[model samples]
Target: MENRINNITYDDMKVFFINKVKELKSWPYNGKNVVIAPLPEHVTVNPDKPSMFCFTEINDDYMEFRRSAFWLVSGTVVMAFMISMMSIAYLAIAVCFFYDGSFESTLFLCFFGSFFGLYVLPMAARIAFFIPHDLPVRLNRKTQKVYIASLILHGNIFRLRPELIFQEMDWKYIEGWVLHRSVGKGTPYYGLHLVENKSGDINRLQQACLYRTGAPWSTSEMEYQINNIMSTWSYCQHFMNYLPVPDETEKDKNFVFLSNNWLFKWPEAMDKASRSSG
Candidate 1:
């Protein structure tokens, strides 16, 4: 028997489409024509668009392991060398004291051991400091929408929140929503977290989300929710209108992902959202 549920009509599809459009009208990023979607599995986002979504995982596994090993070995060697040198020096000084009673030799050994342990040992430890590998978020700008994908190191797989970055950015130049994970069957909410920028500065302007099993929703579902939210709230209107004029070139170099102005400036858009919601 033909299944009634399987036989949806063209008119039904049209009605469904219209209803979806209506629901999007009240969401953030609604006014702008651009849409941001995650890259398909095995595909990646392009890198030319400023407002597109992208992601990268910072890999610290191998570097951390190697650093720990180097520190252990180097620390052991330094300790052993310092102890041996000090012991030998003290023995020689004792022998000299017994034979000719030379106070100068004993003082020299003491100073030598102190200098090597205090200064040289610390310098040796500095050699083990390794920078963690950075992940890149790739984006592609289409005529109306943006595509995004994440390029993370194989060993570093952890969830992240992108709204913090969005809060910091000059929303005037960004017209799309970064895909985010959602929670519950009701309308999905984006997860915003505070993250530190490359220069060790704390900024909350990034827009991206990572997958978390513990979260109430999956990554794909979150992206759909973000799209719905953007559609309803009209969040992209400002970005499409007032593009930011860069203040300084040197300051721009400080951030890992966002522009200097976006990272440093306080979040005005989020405040507006709060006021409107209230």
Candidate 2:
């Protein structure tokens, strides 16, 4: 038995598991396998074609961060009022200098007005232009390509054209994905880390791009639930084929560290520590 087990390879193990999944497809599971819909209101996944994924709106967290509509509108109004007052003050200053026939004072006031105009105008413009916006990440499984883009909303109306944020990347660039779990303010933040196969360089994808915050579960529970869900993804299944089983040794490696605490140890933590420390 030991000799036979030693002959099995990682690819063999994956094939076994994949076949097992196929066998279980006909089994009753509260009727059938429950399909999860796209999470955010703006996201839509094609049911007929598993390869196509769509996201249309900004994240709720980002919208909330932009503040409530009342505050946003009121704050802008207040800035507008400040600008009006500044304009009136500048006009009054100009009038005073001209009436007093003080050319030197007028020159000094003009310099000061230019300085304030340069800074304040830009600040106001930024506040006015900064609105909560949506960025979409599309995955085309058939093509093995993923696109990160933004859908420009004109006057708060959704548009069809996508503003591509980055050129499409093949699965090879995003294949070695690892979830770096951390807890902040009692909430779990799963950071996506992808490694390039050729260069072995790790890229940390934006947290908002991956997780939807404000779930009811505590940090630990959420981590477990997310891990289970991620395992169902076809991409994740393919990535697993390249993973190290039980033990592997190399200077650098990619693996999921699900614990909220960095000090939390896995079953093989001691072995890994000894190997690295030695």
Candidate 3:
């Protein structure tokens, strides 16, 4: 039988994510606690969270793997071409040696064999790196607690398994979310990130993935931004019952503030800048 969740499209992604969120909310973990199972991180989760926030696992984004492979190949294009040319030259030499009944032909064959192993290694590593695009997040409205359960891939290929790991913290620990900004092709892009203080030190959590309502976009009215990264940030402020107090240590270079204006700024198009200035 065919899989229900494979070869997913953009619309399929929307539906799948919506259903997954619902499933997470309802599923009881081992009949004792409510928890989200492991999901491939990139398919979900906002980055800028702790780099190690989610356990990295191979997802099924073959296209992304292909893209990664393409870039890897491009970076080593010259070297790979040279290797191919040398392999061909060696093979020709080996053929001549074999025709003359020379033992050196076997040595040349061994050198030619090394090229295939080098090519296979990167492809295998890329395959291992691809992960399912699902977010492993569980929220319990009754308890108002959020749980993150990630599965680290372990063991050899013959007995590979997911070793489940998790962290739990109160919702109140969330300080806020931040809007990360950047520009591409003259259009502005924003990523929502989370900030939490559960660890005593205030630091940004992963990206505030608010795909439930819709992807984030800039809006003047905060009300419309609900369920979005920007609105989530506002909600966190509201939940704090006041603006978040800045940590003095946040001024340090190693610190990342949720509201770093410089990190969120994007260059405007020349005409837009000129018009604004005028």
Candidate 4:
């Protein structure tokens, strides 16, 4: 009746992930070949943290999703903030040197000016142009609701607005697409997107990425890459379509949900919804 995560040991998780990797390797695809059968991406592949797919929880009733490069955004924010302070310090230092001649003020100038080698990029000056927090999405099977944070209403920075929270949608109406974005990195990385149509200036809502290219890559990287997304979608499809009375309840869960960020944040929003059987 109640499932709680307690005393889950490292070896227990390692074995669980090992089995998951094996499952992905075998991946019972129903099509003409093994390439087409959608397989679930294993949760928490790394020993340190759940990195590649950015999933933290992959239970039978719900899956939590996270953004890629968690630290990049975090580091960027911190870096931008520090830069902002330093930028102000620039003026402050000028003020202290010309006006106060205080020892601490002079020391402050020497310390940071030398630390930055006399220059800091104007990151904070344009901090307004960046998203404030990492976007996280959730997929709940029981209540069949998808809760998305940071659902983009507008991509343009000039007219940026609030990042909406508590945007819930019926799971049945959601759609999945394998999309690609290029950063001029020569090869573009493809990932899975779960989306729904919105009846406003913004056409789509709950656009979240849950899969990235992972091991057992095909002979041609592109084919396997596409297959990866297809397989991820298939995994979600299976998870949602086939409700299992888990042999082990918490342990017997299947299907990585179409979502993002295995985070410390998704639970508060998704917990009540996922616990239900509606």
Candidate 5:
């Protein structure tokens, strides 16, 4: 009885945090205002098609998946370039003035460097102290909750605006879709989002990754994501609904990015939240 009571307490705590996530107003919800329909329940799976195979960790308690780190590294590059621009600009200005260069030339250098850097400052400041190496999400099967790390960014710009929000949400309230688009297709105009906190009066959906540009038209050599997302979604849905999860042991061994390295342990709070029931 005592053990059961403790489990109940932990479950309640999970619910509490799921509610708390809705209070976070800093999440960049721009361009994700439209509502897209949830994926069809009975989409066909191609046996030869690629699996998104993005699992990082899986266990009796929960399974975790981290978004690809490509954008995170890109953000780091942008941050470095921002600093370099400012430093180079101001350095040139000082050197020019000290050497008795023309006043007009010095002024031009001053404005050029400062303007470019200052333009990058807000973007730099968004990522600020910590560079998010990855966005990890933990799905707890028992509690039916999701703890996710979401990064804010768009296009070539990195706006780590919410600075890596770790949000907990009930599975029922969360919706997800893998979208593909082109400039000829659409960018922000294509994605969908809705989030309200209470009473069904407001949106209660978990908001993350609001600005997916989808499969671009640029004739990428890789297979399109729409082909893979459905399978991945099916895998996650089986785990959540207590159905028989499709076995991907053979597939997982072949083409998945395993994030079990010591370097990529989740944040302490999220680690705890995801493991609370397990």
Candidate 6:
């Protein structure tokens, strides 16, 4: 068994797991078996397909970080507010006891106030924090574009924003296409949507694109339905044409090109390539 495991290549291990799932007759979660075509080789200029160059997927790690940040910020704010409110209530009840001399009423108020701060407020704040607010964006290393999709956290609440939260330096240097388009009268913020590939379609011939956003005047659900029909004819490489934001409007595009030397793990001397060349 040890020898057999050692001989199995990464590609073979993938095939092995796929075959095991097929034998069990269960649909692979998130359709992991779905095979997409290889990235296209040559660029094709097709006037018919305006959205031919855009494709989007989810970045799991970034989404997780955003969710955690939201919870921390919301939880801390709510806890602090509740504690302050309870303290104020306690003081009010004590003053009432001093004036009317109603010891039982004051004691009751103190007990209820403590319970509200300790249990009720925290539970309510947690529930509010758990509500979804942001979506996931995946950046393709070859194209500096962003893609947006609705993300369900733990199978609950749907996130909607598709903005990339990477630092300015990372955004400027990163290669990939963002999936969402900016929409506004003058300057529009980009809109992100969640998308999923269809099952058993080895060529990735089928796809389902879903957009859920709070903003009006954005692309409607029906627009997405129409857009996905066109996505079928788009080549995978076209999805990789992610030009930076300035290129979206400017004519002369000056981009920081990545070098082959920067592709792999390297020693301290090799790490200097990031600065040696543009």
Top-TM-score structure, candidate number: 5
Best by lDDT: 5
lDDT of each: 0.27, 0.31, 0.31, 0.43, 0.47, 0.30
Q: For residues 1-278, what per-residue lDDT tens digits would candidate 2 score against the true structure?
A: 23122243334333433332233221111212222222211112222222101112212111000111111113332453466457557756766665454777677777766665665544433323332222234343334444442222112111112121233445444432223223334543332222223342212222112222223356576665455334323223232233211211221221111111232222353223222312
Please write out the lDDT profile of model 6 over residues 1-278, one tens digit for every residue: 23222233334433543443233221122215333212122333332353321222223111110111121123333443465556557656656654454777667766766666565555434333333333223333332322332222232122122121221112222211112223334222121211222232233211112221222243574365334323422322243343212111222221111111122232343223222322
Q: In terms of lDDT, which candidate is stronger, 3 or 4?
A: 4
Using TM-score as the measure, name the better of candidate 3 and candidate 5.
Answer: 5
Error of 3 at 103 (Å): 8.3
lDDT of 1: 0.27
Q: For candidate 3, lDDT tens digit of each residue in 91-162?
A: 567566554545675665665556544553343333233322232343333344444433333443323343
True-structure RMSD for candidate 6: 15.0
TM-scores for every predicted model: 0.18, 0.31, 0.31, 0.46, 0.56, 0.29
The per-residue C-alpha lDDT of model 2 at residue 21 equals 26
**What would the TM-score be for candidate 1 when compared with the true structure?**
0.18
**Poorly placed runs, candidate 3 (over 4 Å):** 1-130, 149-165, 181-189, 199-227, 231-278
lDDT of 5 by residue, 1-278 (tens): 33222123323333432342333322212222223334543333443332445444666778776553322223353554466556556666666565457787677766765665565554554344345444566779988877766543444443334344566777765555433223222222232222313233222334554222232444341234343455566666667666556444433432212222333456787687788774
Per-candidate clashes come to 29, 0, 11, 6, 6, 17
User: 88 in model 5: Cα distance from truth in Å?
Assistant: 3.4
Per-residue lDDT tens digits for candidate 1, residues 1-278, read 43221243333322333333233221221222322232221112221222212222112110000011111112322443455455556556655654444677667656765665465444332221211112112111112121122221111112111221222222223322233322235433342111112222112123322221112245685455344333322212222223321222222221221121222222465333322312
Cα lDDT for residue 249, model 5?
43
Candidate 2 collision pairs: none
